[model samples]
Target: MSLPLTRLLRKLLHVAAKPMRHAQGKDGYVIHAYRGYGSHSEAFLMGRIFRQPGSRSQLAPGAGRDLMDVGRRMLRWGKSGVEVEVALGDNRTTAITDRDGYFSVHLPLDEPLEHQGQWHTARITACPPKQPPVEGEAQVYLPPISTRLGVISDIDDTVMYTGVANKLKMLYRLFIESAERRTAFPGVAALYQALHEGDDGQQQRPLLYVSRGPWSIYEMLEVFFQHNRIPVGPILFLREWGLTLQRPLPRRSEDHKQALIEKMLGLYDEMQFLLIGDSGQHDPEVYAEVVRRYPGRICAIYIRQIGDSDSRKAELDRLGEELAALGCVMLLSTDSLDMAHHAHANGYIDAASVEMVRAEIEHQLADEPA
Candidate 1:
């Protein structure tokens, strides 16, 4: 569809969704507190207030049910202008939801929090006009002072087989498939778990994910992570598919990812990051640019080889050479095990964890159809 027609349709949909919002408000509003992350003296949390129908129970997956669930998640209406209160460790702050019903809390600590290197709870409440206050808890990850490394990964082809290079197949899998039907890359779960556990197998390094996908698929991605036994991070920075007259299209993926990575670097200035992404898109170029901009902040870059282009390979090799000169190791490999071994060699993960990752890869390969 043309940009103008798409914008018109979205406007109509927004108008139709407004009535459903007030009607559902009879049942009260819900605060969807997404997982957040924090440092010793600062915490950042984000969530949305919505007048949902009621809580949804986990139901058996089927074609019709999956379609309906996707529709429901995508068509949710945000309750705008709602005041949200967030409390963490005796610190309280309030933020009003924007037109999209999203609110963020950036709480600076009066006294530095003692780092236990685990998830902390932040209470969130939203009292919509004349309605009972809805309550939820946001899980905020606080990396321990012992943390030596941080991990940032891409979700599409890096962690899962999303066929992003083929846009039609990518959209089909994204919109039509259930979480159960979605396939994660073999051994990715093990590799990520090891990375999260760190080299000593006791450290609590932070693992943050960045995706170019829309926020509408957040729940589905969570479900996919749980089903695949992947360690759930405190945050998955996703893009908003907003359509306005000033900008009919969403922000460029390269710009969106670069900005988020920069934000992550700034958020945890004490930690260096290991970047993981796939060669199916612009990950190598984007990561290389980040490495250049923030020299020595990135420890390493691992690019999963999903494409078979010799030119692309040469390009990545050149980028790898450039990164090496800046004190970063860039690896372009077709197997997750190779990345795992490299990480182990560089002291990013344990030696035993490399074996575990290898075993998982072998098992997944055996399970593949002949």
Candidate 2:
């Protein structure tokens, strides 16, 4: 299909998915099941089912007002008090969505998934009367047996430059740009790819991306990863954009992130992680805590220094010393090439991959205006 035609079809679907005002309305909701990745002992899958306006509102100026409008629209479309069933690896479970229209199911697997980390299809069907029994498909990834380590990284400034500290520009970058136009930090794609393909150069290490964004933007972020040549993995967003019409949903940030990191640690108990994030947010603090809690479970913590702030430097320095005491190296650098070199030295990636990352950084630098 032509690009215009594809977009037109999506617009039509969005229109058709609008909520009916009546409580017993028959119009169906939309389900967005994110692609999930996990290990042999268990599999994690998550998604959202909304009343389905899908928030097609225009990106007007002013951050606070626009964000409030988006939130209201999502709340308007959330289909609360509904049950969703998930099936994978012959095990099944049912979960009822909260007022926010989000559902998650983590299933245990006694048998091993395929050794090649092949994609497995999982079925998610919304309960009766949310009908015609609307079903959504999700992809579950099982990492290869050659996996040496698992990587958990933050998305905003570490890989893609979303300017999370600047709310308006962040909103503009998210809502207005096409996926291909969204930029990944220079050299990040190459570095992530190297980490994905570990030191032996052929092993496919488990790579996961974690973000604090809402589930509504999951599809757009997947597209961004595709266009930017970043290896996509299970994207675990922190909050549900949907909410009940009668009450307000409190904003959640730091604590929720820490809990999710602990969950990941529990799931992959045998695999150590290489932590990646930027100084613009609470990554230094959150990761320092992870290093303290997990002890030797973290191989290294690489923080991308966002700006020249004495306070930021001091915090990272304090955390770096703390992490070092726990026997994990903490690196604070302004460039992905520095992380690449660290990974290479630590055997996370091979020496040749280090040169590849350096070359990519040089190429990207030359493309920028002097």
Candidate 3:
């Protein structure tokens, strides 16, 4: 089957598989696992348990759940003790699920997970009573020794213009628009691609994308990234919440973003990171605090300026001064071209890639409807 047709068939299967899920409530279910990453001594992985009724054939999206029969169970599913097991090459660990059915495990490897063009497989098993156990696999990522810097990026307005600050528009863009139609900032992909290929333009740097978004949209974001030609890495997202019918509106996570960044910093402690976010949210404050805590760990901070940040120029200036005192430079701009120029000038990318970034921006603008 062709690629598009294959994807369509998978979606159809998911729809067919929904009836079973609708019937199962939250019993033994498929595990929607994501890739994890870490040093040789330690590793991390995460995924959600989805109880959907269906045969194995029905759940076959690239990240689909395992096959399981959804039999009659209690009408209401309450949050309680649920355990899952994970196994790496030479390590295995178990963790319990939270209220929203999200589980994370940190594996301690006796030795380093050496660099190879291979994905470390994580075998995950979920057992809930009466129903058979469902199993799935997730991959882990680790950069090469030649990595020059690490890239930690935000997902919303920084890369794609989701208007997260505006609730209505955020939903419209997120749910209404197709991934192709969703607006990605011009040259952002090019800039990320250039950074992924470090100063030598051939080395693979560790590029981690952190999001305030929930895990429910993981597959959608994967599709968006694939469509936009952005590099795929371990997607670390905030916990899933607000899913209960009683509370339709979920609460946003507190300080998890900075906390996740700090965890990654521990992995690549000695390396410098290019922290990319937008001034539209608390990113400036969060990143500034990061520089203060891990002084010299951040080579530069690029905060995208949304429409008319001029009204808060003094605030931005104060932030710049504080970050400077901690030995971190920051740039507040509206375009990735400026970041490309800075990256090139600061030895983050080859001079030739800077032009690649500029060309991408011009091409993107030219393709846009005026």
Candidate 4:
């Protein structure tokens, strides 16, 4: 009788392991623990299984599976919450959370919404059924990008040359690759300081720094800027999806950047923006596409001539003219300060304010620590 009773109890425990139902939250869906009566049926939320917004969703070898794992735990946070991610399918999208745990994502509506020609919903699974079944759908919409005058700048060679491409060789010098190491173009720091940090009595404007570099470098970058007295602003970063446990989302690098710019444009509709990049790779091409797609939103394009290769410079010059035709200023300068002043005087910023900002930056540059 004792042995029979023990076996029966084991069977009961296995049956209770099943989840009662999934819970729905504000951001996305979540997994929940199964419910049991006269006992603790609280869902420990072991894990989750769902399709990402892609051709294969959770089909990829390492990429999609990791997303599924954390996505489940992300939702299983408290009792009811959403697990958010960039809108699937396209490569460039990223997900972000508002201060209140509310989240939203931006996607290129122009891209194909279907996979293999089949339309699909931005699918997400909910866990631990809510008492009233909360909706986990992301119905929040972002405004368009044509209304703001903003600038998105790069950090590596364009802002500071930390030799990002040769990561293997520069592993030892990572500490030195900071905003302090970020030698400002003669006037660049002043330009950004004035616009973002604000002048004597003027209200500061918003400046967003978007870099392809990892977030790990952000602290050093921040320290460099603060040490140099550069004005601070919202700093966006890619989630730890690739290097860490999180899998690479669709369009991990370039696409993610494009999406971020698009979202920024939508949020600040009336103002145009300035874009700063380098001639090293695809900034010209990328900025060109941005101009073509959202012509009125970009105010200027600044590319640093880090490489002395004539063929590359010529190609960049041609692209600059094309950008100029769209009312965009394309600058290739060795001086950071010159690029900043040029950006300011080209009507991107007020001249007087630029001068003031420039003076302040000069003071910082001169007062280097002993």
Candidate 5:
């Protein structure tokens, strides 16, 4: 569907769902705390306050259950203008939810956190009008000072087998399928694990995943990552697809991804980054822009080939050359093993870990439907 038509349909649906959203009882207000990230001196966390229909419950895997879960998630109404307090250790900060019911807390620490390279818990509380105060805990990852490289990845076709190039198929796979039924690319988990471990096989580098997906599907993606054994990062930078008159459709994918990458670069100024994405979308162009803007901060760029046409391949070849001149190597490959080999050659990952990635590839292939 065209952009305008999609926006119109969404507006219609929003209007239709207004009554259902208001029917959410007073007991349904809840705070959803997302995973956050920070350095020793500062922390950044975000979450949402929503009026949902019912409490979360576990359900058996089936098509009916999956569709129902998707429906419930989509129907959540964000409660805007609410104040949210987040406390980490002895430091505390508060942020008010915007019109979209999203809140972000940025806390500057008086005393630096320990350089343990692990996740810390933050307590979050929100008191919606006429409802009881809701409390939740969020996990914040603080990378060790010994960290060498940072990995920023695209989620759709880069890590998993979501047919993003095709809209109809992508929606079917996204909403109709259960998390257990979704598939990750072969060896992606092992490759990411090796990257997280770094060259010494013990270094604690940051692995950040970015997606153009909506925040409503955050829990589903988390479940998908856990099921595939992919290393979880501090946060999955996702977008909000709010249906408003000023902007009905989400931001352009390239803009969304580039802004997030720039944010990560700004946050980790001391750390060089590895950009992992697919050629199925505008990832190559977006990463190239990042390399051009911040030359030395990017160590390497890996573009997974997903149904690239000859024209797209030609465009990527040009981008690769441009990035190479800027001191960053861009590799366009068909499989994770190739990217693993490149990483090993560049001393980004341990040599022995290359074999581990290969073994994982073979194992994943064996489990696939032939």
Candidate 6:
């Protein structure tokens, strides 16, 4: 038979072979497991319900049970939006399935700070088919550093605004497009070069960036930084997992980003930080939690107030107060370069380094033509 015919024949045989076998003896199932990073490194195991020839005998007579013969369980990992599900069974049950035989349900990991900002683990279990189902677990680590004086700002709107994230329509902005159109908000590039370049005799501490943009865009961002003569460190990004009809997405939240910061902190303990973020989502909240948990790991928090919105400013203020209580500076700006200049002039950045960065930013901008 042709390949198409063969596939159709196989599917037909698969269905025909099952007959009307209800969940009797067979008690096995399948699971699609995924782990989120950083504080969300929790695992949620989802399973389905089914019975085989021998299960009927195992079923106790007059046994009270779910009519659809299905049950689901969850585990806590301090992460959010972990969903799981069972294979296709019945419409009566809440379990939805696809032709490939799968299901999903969302479970969240409790916050780690609640437990002294320490680490925690979670496990989930379920039963299903010829083989017995097994339980799975995931771990969550403490948040990244909490205090800092030196700023680690991305060249993009944490400092410069290429206009990817709409100052007018923030909600409509997504990662890919945001990355493409990103230009430096006036003076922002200069500011980065200034602080990163430093004027004093010493080297400035590193400025780390963890972007949701695809790794493929690395060249563009890198060129922009180097062309502008901005000093920076490793630019962390995700490699394209591949295009799917379901819609492309970044790696799990807290997963890729939080992990990157956490690793950087481990590399330098005494170093405090000045975190910079655009008016985009999560950066403020994520930075807030990081500060709350790490305490002295961060020295300052700077959020660029891109578009006109009081809500984000209010949130940064609240977080700033908390940081202030811990003795950290909280700087919010509509422009990145201004903050960059502040970091440089304050003696937070060395004079020699400032000169280098300033030279670069000047050259890049000056060449842009009036």
The top-ranked prediction according to lDDT is 5
Would you list the C-alpha lDDT of every candidate in the order shown?
A: 0.79, 0.71, 0.72, 0.49, 0.79, 0.45
| TM of each candidate vs. truth | 0.84, 0.79, 0.80, 0.53, 0.83, 0.47
The TM-score of candidate 2 is 0.79
lDDT of 3 by residue, 1-370 (tens): 7775555545534433443454333444657678888765678898767554333344443325412322222222333346888888757899988776778888887754434653577788887666677777888876765565899998878888873445456544544444434557888888999998878867678888877776555655665577677888655565555567776766543376788789888887767889999887888889998888887788999999887456577798898998887788899999898999999889899888889889888887787666
Question: Model 3 lDDT vs. the true structure?
Answer: 0.72
Model 6 clash tally, residue pairs: 56
lDDT of 6 by residue, 108-139 (tens): 33333334332334343443333454444333
In model 2, what is the error at residue 303, expressed in angstroms?
0.6
Cα shift from native, residue 205, model 2 (Å) = 1.9
Scored by TM-score, the top model is 1
TM-score of 3: 0.80
Ranking by lDDT, best first? 5, 1, 3, 2, 4, 6
Clashes of each: 0, 1, 5, 37, 0, 56
Segments of candidate 2 deviating more than 4 angstroms: 1-27, 51-76, 111-116, 164-167, 171-182, 241-251
Runs off by more than 4 Å, candidate 1: 1-26, 54-76, 111-117, 163-182
Write the candidate numbers in order of decreasing TM-score. Answer: 1, 5, 3, 2, 4, 6
Reference-based lDDT, residue 166, model 4:
62
Local accuracy of candidate 2 as per-residue lDDT tens digits, 1-370: 8775555445333322322221123234767677776677678887777664333345443443344434444455556677898887566778887666777787777654434445788788887453667777889877765565888888888887874445455544544444334467878888999998888877677777777776555555665677777888655554554455653673465676677778878877777888898888888888888888878888888888877489778877877887787898889998888898889888889998889889877877777655
| Greater-TM-score candidate between 1 and 3 | 1
Candidate 5 on 291-367: residue-level lDDT in tens?
A: 88997999999999988889888988988888877889999998999999999999999888899999988876776
Clashes (candidate 4) = 37
Candidate 5 lDDT at 291 equals 88
Residue 75 Cα positional deviation in candidate 6, in Å, after optimal superposition? 43
If both were scored by lDDT, which would come out higher, candidate 3 or candidate 5? 5
